[model samples]
Target: MRPQRLSDVVGQQHLVGPGKIIARMVAAKLLSSMILYGPPGTGKTSIASAIAGSTKYAFRKLNAATDSKKDLQIVAEEAKMSGTVILLLDEIHRLDKTKQDFLLPHLESGRIILIGATTENPYININPAIRSRTQIFEVKPLTLTDIETALERALTDPERGLGKLPIKLDDDAKRFMADATNGDLRSALNGLELAAQSTPPAEDGTIHITQAIAEECFQRKAIAGDKNGDAHYDVISAFQKSIRGSDTDAALHYLAQLVAAGDLPIICRRLMVIAYEDVGLANPPAASRTVQAVQAAQQLGLPEGRIPLANAVIELCLSPKSNSAMVAMDAALTDVNAGHNGAVPDHLKDAHYAGAKKLGHGNDYKYPHNFPNDWVKQDYLPAGLKGSEYYQPKMNGRFETQLAEQYHRLRKANQ
Candidate 1:
């Protein structure tokens, strides 16, 4: 049975609760085209149906993957005849440009209230034109309490639920189903219905659902992760941040999530980037070790691959964090982009070219190798950027501390 009203929606109270966006829109009788995005079985379609039922508007359902242009034509015709209609389009990310072009005018004219639903991120998967015209809302996964409440309603409601069936669900069974579905109400309800229908009633004329029966119905809850969706980027971002923050446990947790999702290649690549971007200078050896670990993970592959990945993650997390290198590069790039095209000094220009001495190339250039410590005070930057100090090393670790000391000493000697 579908939700008949907004209050009947299981979760996402942020959008459907009193004084929420959907409730405010319904109260004002002003609806706009919107896209509902989230993992599957998260009440996107249910919310759309509930809105249509409550508003008493003509409602039509179509699948973007299977429906043709003729289906949209029919909906457009009906909306014109009825003055308004709400169309619930599923898998909206799959809608081609042709269908988007067809729906644009209707959406703009306020004749068809479009409720587009997808399990993909709209910003990444949808056409800009379509995304710009619609407000996007994220429907979150249902909590265990919400799933349990829905199951109870289905078992007792007379009109559209299994009220006539004498199904007696034990407390353990109810909790098992709620927890086994992993926040998916649809899976919980379907499993409950299956157990109720197939189980033989006892001598007391009661169909008892036990923990074993519930497990049989729903084997394992699938982890919600889409490699091409927002979840992938979100996990990767969390992983990097954890490492940068020096939180070893948090970094390992996100690493395990990616490992469980079987995205080893992405994990390896992200680890390498984090080594240089977040762990640079402070621990240069960490960068080298990270590169080697990634190579090892790639060669070993899977179960065995996770070991090397874990080794790299722990090393990076515990290593001193530094963004000085990243900042230095960005500062230099900013000057280049700002048209700071100062000519190179003759002494610093390419001197190996033929007849270079005639142009004064390499003239008066101090050879660092010829001096004490194999170093000399020299101008390497362009003429306009003289005296610019970009590499400011942070003294967070022993290596960087030594480097910073040497840098200050050299600057004092040059002065």
Candidate 2:
């Protein structure tokens, strides 16, 4: 049967469930720009389609990976005129920066209710401006139970369903199907359909799913809808975990997998960010080194880039690890998110610009150079966070130990 309604959606109740954010938005007819993010076959496109089918608004679809900038401009023009377009941009991360910029003004003006879809992390892959304007909801893979329910529905439903299939799915067979799919619902259903069509019928007119047959079916299974699909997240997770577990070899292996599979440069850049975030100051060198490595790769291109990348990976794995910087950054972000924004202290404001000094910029600013060792204790943070420690160094290596020593000396002298 056509999966026409939310009730028909096999999984992702987390998004479509009663009183959930999307469901609430739908019920209230309060649609906003949104991005549905998840791995392939988790129904990103299907969900958009369902929303379009159910809502009163106009729906437009385009694959950013293949669509030209001109095509996108036309869609934006249409959206501007209509002002009711639910523009579903599939593979939105593939759009070049210029193509992305084309949509920014339209999004800002509320001409289109953008429903972007991506198998990649939107925060990492999407243009920051477009992403900022949209609400993101992750659609999770279907559970085995959900897959089984989908199978049953497929077998029983009339239209768009597996019709008149005389098949007996033994426990082993069903387990094989579910396990093979790795929570991909479309895969499970397609596999079931293949088994029904190919397996010969017995005297009872029912097909038996034996282990031998299952293996053969799996080997010959048609390429799933997503060729370069679910593997993206799986590989990235492996790379991050390997680095976390301090397995340089494994981390490099995953990196090679992505590079071999044609992952985007920005994806690598994001992982470098994680290198700083998860493996910061403990290995203060990691972030900077990773940044340099990415630049090298970009400049050298492919085969040659692998060398610098390998070196960077080795450095990161061996370097002492700490997440203190990440902790501090996150805490600072929390303050900003909570509207704890404080204006730059007058003394900290720039004085070189015209009329800046007239506005008291840098007025009464202490000349620390005149102090002993060109060092002096002073308030650096905003008023509310003054003297509030953010970077608490973990004493493990040269950088952190030096930082800790400085903090200790500063604290004692100030006291």
Best by lDDT: 1
Query: For each candidate, what TM-score against the reference?
Result: 0.60, 0.52
Task: Write down the lDDT that model 1 would get.
Answer: 0.87
Model 1: worst 10 consecutive residues (lDDT sum): 220-229
lDDT of 2 by residue, 1-415 (tens): 4355555677888887788787778788888888999867777777777777777667788898898888877877787677677789998888788877787777877777788999889889888888889999998877767777777787766667765666677655665565456677777777788887898999998877664465467662211222233444566777887877789899889777756544436346656876786678776667887888888887888777888888887787777777888888888888889988788888888998899888998886888899989877666677876666666778756788887898889877764
lDDT of 1 at 266: 71
Model 2 CA RMSD to the hidden true structure, in angstroms? 8.8
Candidates in order have lDDT scores of 0.87, 0.74
Q: Write the per-residue lDDT of candidate 1 for residues 1-415, one digit (tens) a residue.
A: 7998998888889999999999889878999999999978889999999999889999999999899988999999999999999999999999998888999999999999999999999999988998999989999888878988999999998888888888888776787677666577888889989999989999999999986787678763222423222454677899999999989999999998877756676788899999999999999999999999999998999779999888899999999888889999998888889999699888988889889999999987999999999998887778798777878889888998998899889877775
Model 1 off-target regions past 4 Å? 221-415
